[model samples]
Structures are given as structure tokens and as C-alpha cells.
Target chain A: MGTIARNGWASLEDIRDILYLTDARLDAIARDVPIRRWCECFDLRARTIFPRPKKSQAGVVGYDGVAAADVAALLIYLERLGYELEPLPLVERLMDVIRSNPYLTNAQLSVLWYERCRHKCEPLVLYLADAARPKLAETRRLRTTTGYTIEVATSADGTPIWLSASAPKYRKRRVSTPETCLQCGYVWTRGDPDSSAAHRREHKKRLSYLDPQPVVELVAAVAAGENTISVDRTSPRWKHREIYRRALAFKREFGYDFVQWQSDKGDDDPGAAGVLFCNAQNVIVGACAFRLREYQGRSWRALQWIWLAPKYRRSGILTTRWFDLRRQFGDFRVEPPVSEAMQAFLKKMGDESLMGAPLSSTLPER
Target chain B: MGDMDPAPVDVLNDEPHFLSEPEVAQALERMLNEFQRETDRGAVLIAGEMVSAQLAAEIRALAPPELRGKRINELLKYPGFLSSFSARCDVALLAGFIDASAHRSTVVLRRLRNDAAHSTDAFSLAVHRERLMQMCSLGSGVAASVSEFAAKSVLDDVVYRLKQRGMTLENEIGRNPFSSAAEIFEHLSVRPDLMAVLDERMPKMELAIGVWLLLGLIVHQGKRRRAERTTGDIDDAN
Candidate 1:
């Protein structure tokens, strides 16, 4: 076959090998995930014999049900660990190998690639340097000096209240202190007029390459088959209504089907600690806001907000972190990689499919 | 032939002084011979070295063999063994003088010899003729520097004679000397002064330069045809 044809169908064989799984144990895994065209006759091929020195009862060396089970287990494990699978297989493998053995320096991985996979050196090196490490700490610290909260008077009796301030130095201001409207009505400082007007204007500018954020945020809800992503109802600076409206507008444009509320996983609450949120490394460029809740004796986490810098697509780093986290611990209902133009983009980079089933999004038609 | 071998020779059992001329000759012979056995390309190279060494031996026939030995070594190392490349010069000259005339007809023979001396393959017959011509021209320069015998003229004379004796002049025009006076002077003289003078007076270099320009023009001219080829068939004329 020609190069393009060969490459196009290359992943199909791997997926076929994956779908080569059989037995009652993996049935839920097969059923719970979206079934593609390759799942049919998975059992028949799973049992086919090829000539080889007999090693064990398992017919093939690498394709046994145990190996498939190990893959599933790894997927579940990464979920718990809060890692994202890269859309590219080689990239995913590189990250997986690195994470599994962090002591193996990047040089050692590069040398391994040189020795075992000489032709793949460029991609391996590039992904490692550009995609993998950056994904680990893509959080960009937002310039929060301009963003402000407005406080309005809540007291029945008209009382002169400290309504406006620049960044407040420490003061013993009570929560019960008379709050008057500064800009709208919340208990935070307002920006200077010119700065506030400029900030408002900047917010109105539309940025392309910001689509990955909605997708990342909708991962959990998409898995659950839900339509709305949720952020905390009480962020003093930004209102929940605005956040939801923005997310829905993004969905309408980007075709994301679901969004769910995300609560930061705080200590002293085992249940809340399971929800996903932006980590220190993820603070600047990429952040996933998700919520974990119990449903039918199973924990379900819904991602409501995922924003990445416009520059980070195709790097495979952030996506790998997402999948790595899922495979390690979240034990999520798996999904296929993304499709349409995103698939084309990922395919150009030899990335795996990222359009996996959402942990909570609406189900595909049977 | 015995001198060409690398079998250990215990010189300690012999007189303790500088190696004799025959001894140095033997050493060079041994080095060249060993090179022959180790490489498939080596035999041709050894033959070239033998011719060069034999000619040097004849030139210094009356000198003390010891002085000749030291002189030979100096000559061998003149441009460095790798640069003034005696083995390659010998091969190209030998092929020109003794090989099939058709093989010698290729202007790239000198290049083929040089490449064979340093590398592992023979130049194929079907490369771009201009490239071969360039190689031959460059190889001639190296050969002239190494041989130091003013022998490039002799090779040119032989090529001219072949051309005069009703050999094809078309392929040789750009590459061989007889096509033009500048090339003739280049082939026949080893003097740097003479070549510098010719360079001032020559249009052949201009022609060579023009060929490069023409190549660029052809590429631009055929670009549409090439693009059509990429899309599929260029024409149904096939």
C-alpha cells in the first residue's frame, strides 16, 4: 500500500487488536465505550492460532486477554492518576514510558529511540521537548490586577460603606460591614475607570485556537452525557450565570455537547478530593474545572471548564496529562479520540484519536 | 610483490639505521598491497600507486636509493597522503592510458578514480555528463598537484589525439580539451602562471558558468511539466 493508505489504516489494526478482546469480564468495557466498526468478530480473531513455539495456553504472545486486561487496567489507573492520553500513539507511549520511569532521563529515552526506533527520532525528541513537558506545567498565571469584584450595600439602613478600593491592604473589615455598589455588587475592589474599560474591551476580543478549552472542560460531562458544564456558583469575581452562558455559547460554536460544574478538590473531604481541577503547573496555560459526585454507587466526575492557551494544540502534552490522569485513577468510561478537523490535525502529527466518550455527556444514538 | 606483504619483519636482526630505499619502497609497497586485499577497490588503487612509484623510481634511478626513499616519502606526504592523493591520480592516469578507450572517453574517469580511491563505489556511466565533466576537471587539478610531473598535458595530448583520430567530439566538447583552446591549455600545462594567464583570456569558464545558468533556466521552463507530473500523467502522448 501507499504511504498515506498504510498510515491511515495503521491505527485501525491496533484498535482491532484492542477490540480483539473477548470474555465476560471485558464486556462492560466494550459496551460502556463507543463501539466502532472493528469490534465485530473480536472473539473469533482472539481465538485464532498462528504457528509458534508453544509458550502457554494463551494463543498469541502479545494479544492474550490478559494483555488487553492490562491495557484496561492501565487506562483505569491513569484515570485515577489524572493523566490525559495523547492523541498520538507514539507520543502517548513516550509519555507513558517517561511517567512509568521518571528516573529514566529524557536522554535515555532519546537513546532508546535511537537504538530501537532510529527513524522516529525527530518526532520522539520534538514531542518530549515541546509537547510532554510543557503539558505538565502549562498553567499561565493570569494578570489578575485588572479583574475586580463589586460590592453593593446589603444593609436595610442607609450607612456609608467602604465601597471602593485599589488592592486592599490587610484590614479587619467584617463580612457584616455595610457593602455599597462599587461597580455591580460584590465584596471586592474595583479597577480604575480607564483600566476597567480597557479590560472590558479586551474581554470582547475573540481568540481563535481557544476551542480545546471547551473540549477539555466538557470531557467529564461528555463522558456522563450531560449538556451543561458548571463552575462554582459563588466565585466573588465572576458570576456563575456569565460563566455558564459563555460555556454554552462556546459549545454552540464548537459543537461540544455537555458541560458540568467543577469543584476544586479540597482536603478533609475524600469525596471532593476526587474532582479534577487545574494544578499548579496547569494554572497558566491549561486548566480543567470538573466536579465529582456519587451516582448509583459509582463516582462520576464532570468537567465544566477546560481552558488552554491558544498556542498549545497538537503538542500532545496537555492531552497526555489528561489521559494519563484518567488511566491512572479515574477509571473513566473511555472515549475515542476527537474527529473532524481536530482528527486531521492530530493525524498530521501522528497522534492518537482524542475524541473519546465523555464520562457524562449524552450518549451516541445506538 | 613480496615487499607488498605486511608479514612482520624483525629489523632488529638487521643493521640499526635508517631503512634502506628498497626497504622504504617495500614498506610503501606493503601498505598499498594491504590496501588492495582489504578493499575491492584496492587493486585498482595499488596499480595506480605502482605506476607512480615506478615512475619516481625511474626519475631517481641514479640517486642514492636512501635519498630516493626519503624523497619518495616526502613526495608522498607533500599535500598529505589524503590530499595530494597519489593513488587516485595513478588510477585515473592509468585508466586513461591503458583501459578500454570507451571507459576513458568519460570525462569523469579522473573523478571515478579519485572517488574509488577514497570511497567504495565506481562512478556509473549514466550520470549527468556535465557533472562528470566537472569531476574530471577537478580531479585533473588534484592529479596535477600530486604527480608534479607536468603530466596532465600528456593525458590531454592523448585525449586530443583520440579526438583528432575521428573520435566523437560532441561529448568531449565541454569536458575534454581539444574542443576549445582554453581547455587545451588547461589540460596541457601544469604551470600555475600559465593557467592564471589562460583564465584571464578564456571564454570556456564563461561557457561552464553559462551551463549552470542554463540548468536553472531549464528547471524554470520545465516546472509546469513537473507540476503536472506530480498531479499524475503529464500527457496522453504515451
Candidate 2:
């Protein structure tokens, strides 16, 4: 391929070489006075579409310079379209459009012709006429006989502002099948780029949200001052249900072999009452459930499970809340087979007496 | 011409030979096949090291000047703050230096490196074949069958991108009008009243004075650059 000039401006000969046009043919096209006149009237040199003459040859310069890309696009359009239509009139109207819209450039017109009009069977004059429409020229809406409306809008720099074709939506719907993401359960249509991209974005988001590490950090960082609120069944049933769902999810994520709350149906289990720690966003970050049991004719609330986002643990968040729990439940006992971390926490709390004896009968079946 | 012994019948063999297009293509293909055969632990270690180096460069570029050079080395060296590959990756992601996909690929690369280094059994690409393939696919933006060639290409692409980002950030930093405390003070000295006010109130609090002056100078430089850019855009439109 021939190289464009470093200055971004090309001579007529250079343009002809890049376009692979014969010298005689380009000469014939350039001889048209209006084309040269339009070039001169636009002061193409001032716009860097043409190189300015050296100081010695200032006023003597002719229409020898041009932006190669813009001129190439224009020449290609002319060569391709001139055979079907009257070349002079087409050039005049195209120049008129260029002259009227300051933002419209020959380069943009060339792109529109090549991308939208070149392959179509429609007359080039009709397309040019639509393009010449005042104000509406930005979005050239052409309704084809085949029942599709093609809209072409050009940006200032020759790229499409937006291109759309109003085709039958039902045709695509009939041909495409919907695909469901196995991990996130997001459903989107196959072979549709927008849908596939959306599915990918949503899938990433869902994965990140489910990743406990970041959430634990965020909750830990924000779990101070009035940011966290403790909720239970007494504090709005909906709040309790939402926290209960998060608690279950956290349990499953922690790889618990068996969840105690899974046995209970819902908030209706009067024997079950839970406390949930929520962050400023009202998201459940820590939770614990207690079950009332009569041991030796004395009723006591037995701790079924206590869970906090890992980062929030050992931060004195739970220790401060212990007194409140003691006042509310009166007597609380933890189930046996406590984890080492929990045992350490219990030891720190001076509540080793809260540990209960192992009850093999109450254990869920594996 | 024929009288000079036909110029000693020179064979003209000393001229450099250039490969033809087809010859070059064939040579590349052969090289790719050879690269594909490198599925051993050595390749994983090399890939891990290259990625770590690129990420470290990017972090250096994005870090504040105070954190560059020795301070940054202190953080990234063994037994330092961000010594582990995992810690570096996490810090880069949190600092918005790399996106989630790149971070995930780096994580996968780190794990592969670990398995290759620490495993007692024979270590090869097969150890974490699925994860390696996924990382390559994400890095290269293509879903192809696994090969060491593809893995190397993906790593090359990642390193190239990080290097480019680092260069761009360095260029932007270089463009700042006041890059040092001395330069900032020199610029501020033009306004004697401002300097006088500081001189009176900033005797004991030298650190606070430097920070305040630096912030003001940065904001002023930013506004000036933005205005110049806007004017250039307007001129282009006109």
C-alpha cells in the first residue's frame, strides 16, 4: 500500500496513486471547474484538507492539495456512482450538501455511500437527495420497497452517528433460541450480541456478589457506630425473613454439612427466634438463631447457630451485643460441637458455662 | 564491461537475504508448534514471573511519587507488604489498576505457578488444565483448545497491555506542570501575597504547608490543561 504524506495532506497525483486510478481518468474528473471551485470555496487548505503553499509561492498555489482520505472517499464515490447518474449534477448536489452543513464533510458522505448505499439497488440520486434534506439530513431515513426502513446518521468525523434498520422483530424471535446460564440462572437469547454481553455482565456481577470475601470486608469496615442494626422477628417480619434468607445462604457458603434452620419452615416456628446484624445498607452480615427448650423443667433458649461474616469476627462486634442478648433471652446456651474459633470467642466472653452437653438425638441425619 | 574479466564473476552472495511472505509464515508456524510443546513447569514459572513483573510496573506507574522507587520495592519485595502474588493481584484490583477479568486471570496464573512449584508429583500444564485454558481464553478473548503456545500468547498480550498502560500513566505524570515540591513552591512564589500568608502561618507545620501547596498547584494545573484542551477542540470544530 502507498503511504499517506506525513503532513496528512496529499497532492492530486498522490490521491490518484492511493486510489489506483489512471492518470487520464483522474485528470478528466479534476478538469470539472465546479469541483475545483468547491474545493477553493471551502478554503480546504485552511481546514488542513490541503497543505498550505510555502511563503514564496503563497498566492500562486492552485487546487493541487487535499486530504487524501477525504478526497479518496469522494473520488471513489464519484467513480462508482457517476456511471449510473449524470456526473455533473450529482457532484453539484453533493457539494451543495457539503457547503450547507458546516459539520458535514466529504469524508462522512463517502462513508455513508460505501457503507449504506453502495450495495443497495436504489438509485444513487435518490439517496443523495435524501442526504441533502435540511436538518433531517443528519438522520437519513429511507424506506425501502422491501418493507424495511434504513436510517443513517453521520457524526462530524465521518463515522455513523447511529445506523438502524426497522426490520420485522418477529422474524428474529422465531429463529433464535433462549439460553440459560447454568451458574447464575440468567436467561438470554443465543447468538444475540447484546443479550450475550448482558448475560456476561450479569453473570460476573452475580459471582462477585456471592463471593464472601469482599462482602465480609465491606461489612467489617462499615460495621461500626450506628451503621449496623440488629433485627429479629419482633422487628418487622419482612426484615426478619430477608435476614433469615441471607443467613441460610451464608451457612451454605461456609460449607456447613447441615443447617439447623433448614428443618424449620419459616417465621411461624414459635420455638425459633433469631437475631440478625445488618450493615448500613440493611444487608445481613451476622446472624444467630435460638430455639426454646425445656431442660430439667426450666425453659432456656438454646443457641442453634451463630454466624458472622469472617472479617467481622474477633472485632468485638459480637462481644458488645452479648449483654443485650442476655437481657432479652434471660438464659442462653450454645449447642455442643462448637468450632475452635467459637470456643475461643466463648472463652473471651467469660461464658464457658454457656456451652451445653452434646445431644446426639437432636443431630440431623447425614 | 566485458574486458574487466566480467567483474571477477562476482556471485553477489554477500547481500542479506530476505524471507518471502510464504517462507515467513511457515517459519512462524514452526515456531508456534515448538512453543506449544512447552507444557512443563518451567513455562508456568516463566509466565507467572512475567505477569508479576508487568503488574509491578503498572503499580509503580499508578502509585504516587512518594510510593515509587525504594518505597514500592519495600512493599513488593519478599516479606514486604504486597510480597505474595495473590496480595499484589488483590491490591491491583482494589486500586482499580486492573479489571475483574484480568484479576481473575492473574489469580489463575498464580495458582498454576504455585501448583507447579509446590507439587511433589510430576508438574505440568495438565495439573490445572481447565483453569489454564479458561485463563488463556479470557486473556486472548477467544475460546480455543489449550496449548502452551496459546498460554504464552495470552501472557504476552497481558504483559503488552500492562506495559502500555504504565507508559501512558508515566507520560501523564510527566506532563504535570509541578512534579516536585520545589517546582510547586517556585510556581507559587509568583504570587507574593499568597507566599507571605503561608510564610506567616506555616512556620511550625511544614508538612501541612507542602500538602496544601501541592493540592492547590495540582488543581490549578488541571484546570489550565482542561481549558487548553477545550480551546483546541473548539478550534478544530471551527
Candidate 3:
């Protein structure tokens, strides 16, 4: 007796194991005595199993192995009998159904049998009739609801098949094509009036998010040669919630996974110090955040996140005031995975001492 | 004819610290040696291009057999996917030929190279000193004027590290580099048209820029296939 590999080819003994049939019973069935001599009428040996050499023992052998496809076909044909060993003429009819739709796998056949064929005497005719009934009903419903005419034709065996579905004879409205904004990455349909209006609003909103308008004092300060302002978590100005909000937005725009500030955690450290850069028009075009950390008994100012508006970039706005920043935040160290633009800026500074160790190195270990 | 001449004051008395001929010669020699050690902006840019070209070659060699035949020059030239040095570095990192530090160094070098090439003003270490510092560490006593040398050293170190990493990867994979996701799927008998659709959609999803995600997918698929094989299951679900 051969054992079956899971999901692999099954021999006669394996099939007996699956069906819980005794060797005597399977042999009796195969010999065409039981199950109304169905196996004999259909010639199961000719259709079901093709002989192949055993995989375990090669060379000197007889054709003993069965193919998975042949095993599946046999299983599907036997499944029509259900739990009852008493066989019916339905074996040939199921074989005809399998021959017509050869692509249906054993799994699919099992599903179909369970859904519409199980416990029925004339499963094939009933299954075909049941499958076509819904499609015909759906066609009728579609014609009535959608004002479209659908044609259903029947084959010689009376299985209804769809011919075509056509719309009513009326001019169709053209669909709107989707358009994307190159600057802000906004996408909207072109021909839709409402969508176009929404796109305009979204475009303005996204631009504002990228380049936030500065407060009145900050604007006045920019005009007074005080273009940049630094505020730590402990600073009096930090009491205002607006700066923190803008900082969070800038952090999000900078692609940081978390926008929550360290100060928000209520740490004893000074938390983050933000330096906002206002452009010539007094718009807060850029922001840089730093954490004042004590490492190895020395204060280290680590750069957390830095971002500038797209237009104000490369204008030497940050570079010109770098010394002032260094003076304010002593021993500045940039975080790792530094941006290429920042790398260029660091190079432009021409100060090797400014290239401090990574921010992680400055943090206390857990 | 008598000519009246004024007495010459001895400058040596006033300046006793004036060097002898050999001392002056030695001093001049020292300055000349220091000048030779300093790498100019043009030299740094050229060195960057050279290092990038070599790194590109090493990466190309480590690529799968299908991509190995594609010329590095063609791939790293204008309009190519790996045209920019940054892109090449990213591909090298994704392909596992170089680690993150090496990738960062390459990026720094590329930035320095761009600054050198694009700057209209005269090349000065004053401009790119901090960037060069980011790539390579200098001696504690090293003068600020020798930043160009530091830049050159960083480029050399990057080239050497990349070469070593490529060799290691080749050894680990037994000279057969891991195939890309598309190639693996192709080997698994996935339809070419489906793979083509994936290829077209992947760039739109920005997956092409960061292809390590696809590499991760390939590894996952390989494991799943092995698991299916072990379980003796026919995996038609994919």
C-alpha cells in the first residue's frame, strides 16, 4: 500500500485511506461489483490513473505512481456519490460534466458539488440549470434598472449564456481626466468643475503648509534685520502654542515619522530649540530644531530636524547665520542620514570642527 | 672725479633673525611640499568622478547576471536611472554591496564634487571644509588649509571600502548575486506581462527610487516558496 504526499499524487491505498474504505471494499468497487458496476461501465483504468515508476525506488520498477491530476479527477467523480457507498448512474454524467469543463480543479468541483449538487439525485442537470438561473435573472434586472438591453442565449443543452449588453441609443457624457499638480503633488480631475475648485483650495492649503505665514512680530523682526529667532522649550516665547504647531507641521513636511516634540514628553532637559527663518517677504520659510542634550558631562546641541521652503533654498539664508547658531547652541552635532543639501551646506561652512559626532552618540543609553 | 657715498647701515644688526641660505632653502622646500599635498577644487572634483566611476563598476559587477552586461558608463550617464552619484550610491546600498556608512560617505563626496563643479568662484577649502570633514576625519593637528587632502583621502577610503564589500558579497553568494524581484518572479513562471505591469506601476509608486523594498519582497517570496515546498502544497494562490 502506497502513502499519499499532502496535496500530491494519491495511490489506490491513499484514496482508500481518505475515504476510510477497507482494501476489500475499494478493490470490490474497482472490480466493478459494488456501486452498481459504475467503474466497469466507465472503464476507470483507461480514464483515471496512468502508471509511473515509484519515486522512492528507481530503476528496477513497474509503473506504480499515479499523477495528481488523475487522482483529483477520480476523487471528483467519487465525490458525486456522497457518503453512501450505493452508487448510481450519475458517475457517467459527472464524467461528462468534468470533460466539458476540464479546467475546474478538484477544489472548485468540491465547492460546486457542495453548493448546488450535494444531496441531489440529478446533480449535473440541476447544477447547470441553477448556475444559469441567476445570470438570466441578473440580465433581466439590469435591462429594467439601467435602461440597457441585454441578450441571453441558450445552448443545445439549454444552459443560458450571455450574448451582449448594449446601452440605450443616447449620447454619453465624456469623463473627466485626472490632472496632477507638479508643485504640491495635488491630483484632481480636469473636466470636473467642483473638483477643479477643490483643487484650487487644496493647492493654496498645501502651499501654506509648506510656507507658513509668520506672525506680526516675526514679520517686523525680519524687517529689522532679525530674520531668525531661536526659542527653546523654556523660553518665554515657547509659551505660545502657535510656534509649536508650525514646528510640528514643518517636521511632518520634512518626512519625520514622528512630529511630536521632545518637550511634549515633559522631559527635564531643555527639550528642542527651534530657529525659524523668515524670507525677505517676512514669511516663515524655514525652521531648524535642536535638542540641548548633556552627554559625557558636556552640553551638546544636536540638530533634530531642519527644513526650508523650496523657493528660499540655496539662497545662503542658513549659511550666513550659521555662526550665530553655533554661538547660541554650542558643540552642534547633526543627526545621521543627513540630507544632501545639508551636506553641501556643511561643506560650504568650511569648519571641520562643526562636523560633530552623530546625535545618537550624544544620547544617554538605555 | 670724487663721488660722495653714504654709509650703509647693517640690516643684519636690526634683523638678526634673518635665515641663512640653506635655512631659507629648507623653508621654501617645506612650503612647496605642503602646497603639493593640498588638493585643489578641480582635483577633488576629478577624484570624485573617478571614485564614483570605480564604485559604479564594482556595483555593476555585483549586480545579477542580467544587469552585469549593462555598461556602468551607460547606466551612470545622463538620463539613466543610476545617472546621479547619489542614485548610484543608493543602488549600491540596496543591492547590499555597501553599508549605510559607506553610502553616507559617497553622498558627502558627491555633494562636495557638485559644489566644486558648480561654484563660479575660485576653489577654496573655506567653502567645502565642513563637508570634507563629514566624509573623513583629519588629524587633530591638521591645519585648516589642507581640507582638499582630507577630501581626497575620504574618496580613496570610500573606493577601498566599496571594493572590499563587493568582494565579500560575491564570496557570500558564491559569485551568483541575488536576482531582482522581477527576475525571481520570472524564474517562478510568473507571466512576463504581469511583471511588466508591476514594473510600470512600481515607478509611479516611487518604489523605483527606493528599490530595497522590492528586494525585501523578493526575499519574502523566496521564503514563502520554500515553506510551500516543505508543506507539499501547490501554491496557485499567488
Candidate 4:
């Protein structure tokens, strides 16, 4: 508590969102690794992969099974990477593993994190840097080289090490007990460990702000059971006026979901990739669509649209599935002059610039 | 849409640049030199007494609230036994600031520096190949041997990690100011505010130094309590 004297502590929800995004790497890993059946679980072999690995037998096998601890990526990838490594989702089938499994270890979580964050680590680094920017008001004694990074206690991701700050200087002469320097002639004793009480809380509580992933996924799975999240198709339930009116009302309240996504088969670009967020029984809840579009004759990938049903906003679903979006569109640039809600989401992203140049055709009125 | 979005990603065309291995090694050397000058009296002796004492304070800060003041003074007696600059490099590695290769280099270099410091005769890289062979990074994978050039090359990249290149000393202090509290106290003693404390009491320089030491001690006592101090906490005391 003393370590954090000035700044306000983040709420559980704030921690949840951050942990969710950090764990986005895990979600990515689930999607990326190729899952050939090896008994009950999926086998991730280094040799099966193309390029350098297939030439020589350097590849080792890894598995993602139903068990909690059984969650490592291919061994070769592990050797090449560390906490900073972010590997892309090589297989789409890990989705089933993630969807079905409830428990995962810290190591497995890290591997999944790498899979989600693979190649996107630089951005993740920036994202963390944005949130845990070195404190501005922090003062240092000039000439003192003792360096310390006031750790964002809740952040799961950031620079792993900071300079160690020392305690009071003490010395012992002829006496058995050492006397500490106290200019005022005050008596002092080495206080106690930061927490004298039993450190019964697992390392996660000490190291991380909150335990992540399992519960959030459990909630999502429960919610998934109650409501459907379809890949692409939309249900006729969208035509129901009462539901439509409520959806519109939500749009009015949240400045999102102004209109239902009308799948335009005619305007389909082969480069266009999309997914739909569906409610109970396939009600079109939300859709995030991306397409490769030419701008000023320069070709660039563009986010066609990200429409979410009002209720789902801030629910962590969008962020949880954000890796899927990146996997498909390769990090789509959002059209600027976005809706207020979209802007809020971008701000959450910690890098507003990801909302790149606005779509030429879908221009918001100035 | 009349206006086209510039494509959301083009604005971020440039990625952050990282130094190559040689450059990183050079930077490590410069950083180590700077750290020595800053922490020690410009000598690279066993740094435990200088840096480790400060680091001890830090580990204490993270200690349970009760152990704040009286813990870990034994380190002062046998300072060299506590650690070397290489151990600090280990902390840097643990902190994830430096990558694996850099960390490996630190382990290797720490031994070389220790050997050179303790050597009776003039120390040379050429003579230390046997020692170099002991370094995990420099050691022969098989029952093979390494050339002096190879050991020297390892030594080059084995530069220590101090402050990151772009990060300011302020940033490092912001993270853990008390680790270098003594230096900070010395630095602050010359400040106009601290001097004003002297100016108000007595203009004599000797008494002022004594007063400053007392104040620094008092500040150290404040370290025992684990709470953020308001700006007034220190200023009003003065």
C-alpha cells in the first residue's frame, strides 16, 4: 500500500480488460497452431511446418490437450521465443481446444499469449507502454543512479525488470548488532517483509493483479450457450420489429449498431474477411468486417466495419476475439472520424493510430 | 464517402529501431562505465558495497512492512559475498529489459572481470582462454577449446545492462528512487531548498554538512514507513 502512495489503484474491471487483452495472445495461439490428431489431443510438430524446419529434423512435438497443464506450443517455437515472443495463430483448430478447455497453466497461458501476440508483440509493447508509461511526477535524487520502475501492479505485460531501490544504509563496528543511520538519533529496526502475514496467495496474486482467462472464458462459454455467436450467417430474428426497435434504441443510447449489417454479396472483394456476432438462435448481434481497398491508388487493407450489438459493448468479447480479427485481416486500419463508441474502443486499444485513414466511400459527414 | 481514410496503418510506417549486437555491447560498456562513476567513486571494484546496499534497500521496500528498518544489514559486513556488477546484470535479465543473448554475455563477462580484478599479474584476454572456457556463452560445447579472439569477441558483447539507452535517469528513479537514496541525498544536499534550510539555520558550511547528514538520516527513517509521502512531508521537516 505504501509503494503506491500517489496514484489511484485500478478497479477489478480495469484489470479484467487489461488481462483480457494481454491474454489475447493465448486466444491467438489457440487459433494459429495446426492441430493434427495425436490420440485425444492435437499434435503441434515442428517438422510438419514448412521452410527451415521441414528441411532438417529440428522440429519437436507439442500438444494442446483437454488437461489443464497440457498446454505448450511446438518445442522449437518455444526455444526460439521467450516472454517477449509473440507467435501467430498457425492453426484454426485450437479454437476447439480453447472453447472446450476450462483450466490452463501459467506456462500454457504464456504460450497461448504468444500465439495471439505473435508478430503483434511490438504493438503489445506499445500498448503496455501507453498504459504503464513511466510516472511523470516520480522524482529522483540528482546524482543517485539507483533506478526503479514503479510497476503498474495490475499489468501482466510490460518491461519485466526494473532497477532495485535500496533500503537504509547500516554498518556494524565492534558491536554484535548493526546500527542503521538515522540522522535524528531515532531508534530503528528492519521493519518486516512487505507482507508479514502469510503470503498464502499464489504467486499470481503477488505478481499479477488478478487471475485471468479461465473465469472469463467460463462466462463466455455460459453466455455462448445462452446466445449463439455465429461465424457469418444472420438469422431472420433481425426482422422482428420489437427486437429491431430495441437494437435501434441501444444504437441511439450507445451510438453503435445504427443499422443491421446487410451482407452485400455483390460488393464482395475476395480479400474481404468477416465474422458475425450472433445472439440466441443466430440473431445477428454484431459483425466485424475487413476488406482490402485501394485508397488514392495506393492499396491498403481497411476495416470495412465493426458493428456490435449495444449490450456486448465493453463486455470484453470484442477484445477477446480481437486476435481472430487480426488473424483474418492482418490488423485492419480503421476508417477515421469513427463513431464515439468506436473511438472509445480505439482508446481502449491504447493506440488510436490503429484507426488509420478513413474509408473513402464510408466517410462521416464533417 | 467523399473522403477516403488514409488506411489505418500507413501512419505507423516506421517501427522502433533496435541496435545491432556490437552496438548493444558498446552501449552496455558505456552504461557500465556511467553506472560505476555514478554509483561507485569511478572504480569497478566489487560493487556490492555501493550498488548492492542500495539494491538491498529496494528488496527491503518490497519486504513485509514489519521488516523495513532492521532487515538485511549483514550484507554490509561481507559486501563482496553479496554480489558483483554481474549480479546486477542478472537482475536486469530477470527484469526482462535485456534479451537472452545479452544475459548470456553478462554471465561470461562477469567472470572475466572478476578474474582480471583479482589477477596478480597484468590481466590479458589472451591468457584467460581457460577461464573463458568456463563461461557458459564462451565454453566449448564439446571437449573443444576456444581461441583468445573468440573469448575477446564474447567479452565485447558482454557489456553490462544499466539504464536503457533512451530512458532518463529520472525514469529509472521514478521506478525505484530509494535504491540510490544516499546518492539522491548527496545530490539533494546541494539543492537551493536544502541549502535554504542551512541558510535559515546558520550560514557556516561545516554545520550545514552536519545538518544535511542529519536530514538525510531522518529521510532514511521515513523509509521505514510504507506510504507515499506528500511533498510537504520532506519540505516541512526542513
lDDT of each prediction vs. the true structure? Answer: 0.34, 0.52, 0.49, 0.36
RMSD of 1: 36.7
lDDT of 1 by residue, A274-349 (tens): 2222322211234344445456655554333444444564556455565444543343332332336545644554
Question: Candidate 2 lDDT, tens digit per residue, A26-121?
Answer: 456555543444344333332324346678765643545666345545444443433222223223334434546657565646533443444342
Candidate 1 ranges beyond 4 A from true positions:
A1-259, A262-283, A291-296, A302-307, A327-329, A334-366, B1-238
Shares of reference contacts reproduced by the candidates, in order, are 0.00, 0.00, 0.00, 0.00
| lDDT per residue (tens digit) for residues B71-117 in model 4 | 43443234632344555455544644344543454455455556656
Q: Where in model 3 is the C-alpha error above 4 Å?
A: A1-158, A163-179, A187-202, A209-217, A220-228, A234-255, A260-269, A358-366, B1-238
lDDT: the better of candidates 3 and 4: 3
Q: How many residue pairs clash in each candidate?
A: 81, 0, 1, 57
Model 4: residues with Cα > 4 Å off, grouped in runs: A1-267, A279-284, A358-366, B1-238
DockQ of each: 0.00, 0.01, 0.01, 0.00
The candidate 3 chain A region of ten consecutive residues with least summed lDDT is: A119-128
Candidate 4 on A152-191: residue-level lDDT in tens?
Answer: 2222333332222221121222323323333222223333
RMSD of each: 36.7, 36.2, 35.2, 41.9
| CA lDDT, candidate 3, residue B173 | 33
DockQ of candidate 2 against the true complex: 0.01
Candidate 1, B-chain TM: 0.22
The interface root-mean-square deviation of each model, in the order shown, is 39.6, 19.8, 25.9, 27.0
